[model samples]
Target: MNTLPKPAMRPARPEFSSGPCAKRPGWNPENLSNAVLGRSHRSKIGKARLKEAIDRTREVLGVPDDYLVGIVPGSDTGAVEMALWSMLGPRPVQLLAFESFGKDWVTDVTKQLKLDAEVLDAPYGKLPDLTKVRKDADLVFTWNGTTSGVRVPNADFIAADREGVTICDATSAAFAQDLDWAKLDVVTFSWQKALGGEAAHGVLVLSPRAVARLESYTPAWPMPKLFRMTKGGKVTLDLFEGATINTPSMLAVEDAVDALKWAASIGGFTEMKRRADANLAVLEAWVAKTPWVAFLAEDAATRSNTSVCLKVVDPRIAGLSADAQADFAKKLASVLEKEGVALDVGGYRDAPPGLRIWCGATVETSDLDALTPWLDWAFASTLDALQAA
Candidate 1:
C-alpha cells in the first residue's frame, strides 16, 4: 500500500452547536421517511401520536396540572410570537435583554407592536438586573441566551405572586435544566434545539394565569387564526390535546415523539441533566488550561451549561481584534466540519466575537471531550497561517 502520511485524529461525531444541534448518534433521516407518512394529521393514528407527544412533553417537564401544552407552527419563534401578541396589550411589560434573541423581542415589542414597557437590560456577558423588574409589569425573558451562552441562574428572583405574568422563551433551557413551573406563566420552546427533533413546530406551555388571561382579555386587534388560542370566545382545550393550530408534519411529530420517548426511557429530566452536566464539565476543563481561552460569562454559577461561550484571552492574541477572532472561529468551524471533526462553533452573528459551543443534553460528552483538543489544534493552525501570510 502506498501511504503519504497518517491523519492526526478522527472525531467520533461533529462538535455541538446550540440550535439545530448535533443529531443523536445513529439518527437516520430515512427512519423518518419510513414513518407514518402521508397520513392526515387529523386521522386516528396521527391524533394518537400527536397526543402522545404532548403527554410525554408534559410528563417529562413536570408541568403543573393547571398548565396546558399546545403544538403550534413556526417552531419556537411562533410559540413566542403567539404569546407576545396575545398577552401584551393588557399589561405593562418588563422586557429583559442580555443577548440577540432578547434584543429581537425588544424590537418586536418596541418597534413592531409599539408596546409600552420597562426594559431590564445588560451587556452580553452579564445577567440582566432582575431587581429592577416592575412587580406590576408582565415580564419577558429567555431562560438561556443561546447567542451569548449565558443564562439566568434561577427564577428565584421573581416574586411568588406578582400581579403581572412571566412569559419565558426557554427554547434552549427547557428539558436540559430544571424549570420552576410555579414562577412561570407562559413558557415556549421548539423541539429542534436540545431534543434533536425536526423543525416546523413549537411546544407552547401555559400556566393557569396565562389561560386565565386568554379567558378574560382579548387582544385589541383581530387575532390571526394561528394566534387565536380561543374558539368562540372560549379557551380551546382540544388545542392542548391533539388539534394543532395549523397543519403539522406528521413525520416531525413522530420524530419529536421518538426523542421524547428516548428521553423518558433513559429517565427523563435526570438523564438530561446528567448529560448536560457531563458536557459542561468537559467544556470547563477545556476552557481552564487552554492558555488563550476563558469563559465569556464572568460568574461561574451563571455560566450556561447548554450554550457555553469562550473568548480568547492571551494579550498577544488580542491584537487580532474581536472581528478577527470571530472570523478565526468561523474558519475553525469550517475546517473541522470539512474534515468531519466538528460543526458550527462560531458565535451568533449578532453576538460579540467569540466561540460558542453547545453542551446540550442530546450531545454525547465523550464526543465533546474528543473534540476539545482539536480546538487547540485549530487555533494553533490559525495563528501559524496568519503569521505565514
Candidate 2:
C-alpha cells in the first residue's frame, strides 16, 4: 500500500468541537483576569458586568432596542426549555425538525410539555417544507441544524404579519449567520458556540410579541423557578437588565464579555459572518476538488456556514456496511486527531458517517485552509490502511 505523507502545515489552534468551539484569534486566559469574581452576582459590580455582557451582545448582534435580552442558565438548552415551558401552551404549535437538536425540541414539546404540536420532519440532510408552516400556529425550529449542518436559507417563509410566534434555537447561527430578528419572536443562543466563550449560560432575546404572550398566557404545567420570566403576570424587566434568576458563573460572564469585546473590535456581526463564510468557502473548495467527500447538506442553499458536515462519497467507503462505514469515518477522524492537525472533527454519533467541522466566527479562516490539506492526507492514509487490512 502506498503511504501518504503528512501535511506540512497545521491549524495554529485546533480546538474545534462545534459547541465550545474555537476561541477568538489571539485569545488568552489573561484576558479574563479582570472578571468580576469573589463577589455576589447580585452585587452592583456583578450586575454591571452582566449588563455589560447583555449590552455588548445587543450592540454586536444588532438586536433591536425594543427586544429584551437576558442571561439565562443551562446554556442554549435552558433558554429553549424556558421558552417552551413558559410561552407555548397558549397557541397551536408547529415544529420544524431536520436534525438532532430540532428533534429534541419536538420531544420536549410532545412528550414533556405534552403539547399536541404538528411535527414537520425531514431527514438529516434536508429541511422540512416551509410552505406548510402554519401562520396561525406557534413555530419552533433551530435556525441551524448543528449536527447535520443544514440551516434555513432565510426567513422569507415566515409571514411578516403572522399571528404566531416563531421560537428559534439559534445557538449555532447567532453570530455566524444573519438572523432576521423581526421574524423571530424568541431567539436563543449560547456563548459557547460562535463566540467560543465558556458554557452554562444562554442569551435569550424576546421580541415584544413574545413578552406579551408570556404576560398574557400561563402554561398548563408547573413552571420551574429558573424558567420563570414573569412575576405578578408581568414580564420581569429586571432579568433583561441583568438580574439573573440564579447565581451565574462570573468567570463565564467575563469570558463572554471578552469575546463580545473582541467581536466588536473585529467589526462585529458583519465581520463575524464574513469570517464564518470564508471558512466555509475553504471547506467547499476542498470538497469540490476532493471526489472522496461531499457535503451532507443536500442543498447548497441550506448548507451551514458554522457546523459544516461532510460525508465520504468514495465508493470504497460508501459501499461498506453501516457499521463499517462509521468505523472508517471514525478512523479517518482519529488519524487526523493523532496527527494533531485537527481535533474533534468526527461526525455526530446520530449523523451519517462523515466529518463535522466547526467553521464558526471564532475559527481562523487560515486555520481551515491549513487544515484541509491535513484532511486529505488523513483520508488517504486511512483509506490505504483500510484496503490493506
Candidate 3:
C-alpha cells in the first residue's frame, strides 16, 4: 500500500478553474466602485465606461490602430458565432479543429450553417497539419485549445498575402501569449480567461479586411438582430465605438475595467505572460520528476501555458478501462478538493480522462508551487485506495 504523508502546506488561494478563473491578486469588491449602475448603456457615462474597456484591451494587447475593437454579447462563443454567420458565405472555408471548442466551430460551419467547409482535424494532444491549409480558403481556427491544452506555436502557417481572411478564437491565449496580429483578420476573446474578469461578455477585434468582408458580403440565410454588424452595405461604426446592440451589465463592465487596470499596473501583457509561463514551469518541473503523470500535449512547442492538461502514464491507471480511468481521475480530483488544495481540476468532459489545471496570469506561481505536493499526495492516496479495493 502507498504510504505518502498528507501535505501540510496548502495554497493560499485555490480558485483554479479554467474558465472564470481566479481573479487578479489583491482584488477586492471595492475596486468596482466606479461602475455606472441603473443607467442605460447608451447614456454618456455608460458608453464612456464601455469604450474604456475596448481602449484598454487594444493598449495592453498591442492591437493595430486600424483594427476595430468592440464588446459583443455571449462571451467568446458569441463573438465567434457572430463572425461566422456574418462573413463566411463569401468564399471557400477551411477549419482546423483539435479540441472541443474547435470541433464546435466545425459543427457551426457544417451542420448549423450548412456550409461545405473543408475540415482538418487531429486527435487530442496534437495539432492539425498546418501545411495542408490553403491560402485561398477563409480559415477558422483556435489559437489555443483550452480543453486539450494544445495551441498553435505561432502564426507562421498563415500566408502573409492571401485572398482569404483568418478568424482566430484566442479566448485563452489573449493575455498569455504573443499573437501575430498582422496575419489575422478577425480575433475574438473573453475577459474571463487570462485576465480573470467577469463572464458572458466577449471582445471582437476586426481588421480593415474583416470590415470590408462584412460590408461586402451578406449571408443567404436570415441574420439575427444580435448578429447584424452591417447596415445598408456599410459596417456599423457605432458598435466599435461602444454603442452595444443590447443592454449590458454595468457591474460586469466595471469588473472588466478593474481587471484591465490591474493588468496595466503590473507592466501589461509582458508581465502577464511571464507570470503564466512561470506557473507552467512549476508544473513542468513537477511532471518531470513525478513518474505517474505526463502532459496531454504531445509536443512541447504546442503545449498551452494556461490550461495545462495532464494524463496518468502509470501502467496501473492506464491499464484500466476508459470509464474506470475516468472514475479514478474523478476520485483524484475529489481528494484534492476535499483537502481544499485545488478545486475543479478534473479534465474537460469531452477530453481524455486526466487533470486540467489553470495556470493563467491571475494565478500565482506560489500557489501552483504549493499545490504540487498536494497533487502528489492525492494521487498516492487514491492509488492506495484503489489497490485496497
Please, what is the whole-model Cα lDDT of each candidate in the order they appear?
A: 0.83, 0.93, 0.95
Instruction: Encode model 1's per-residue lDDT on 206-317: one tens digit a residue.
Output: 9989988888888877678888888776789999989887889988888888888788888898889889889999989878777878888878888888888887776656
TM-score of 3: 0.99
Better of 2 and 3 by lDDT: 3
- Steric collisions counted per model: 0, 0, 0
Order of the predicted models by lDDT, top scorer first: 3, 2, 1
lDDT per residue (tens digit) for residues 99-179 in model 3: 999999999999999999999999999999999988899999999999999999999999998789999999999999999
Global Cα RMSD, each model: 3.1, 0.8, 0.7
Weakest ten-residue segment in model 1 by summed lDDT:
1-10
- Per-residue lDDT tens digits of candidate 2, residues 11-35? 8988778978988888899999998
TM-score of each: 0.95, 0.99, 0.99
**lDDT, candidate 1, at 344:** 81
Q: Considering every candidate listed, which one attains the maximal lDDT? A: 3
Q: If candidate 2 were superposed on the true structure by all CA atoms, what would the RMSD be?
A: 0.8
In candidate 1, list every pair of residues with a backbone clash: none
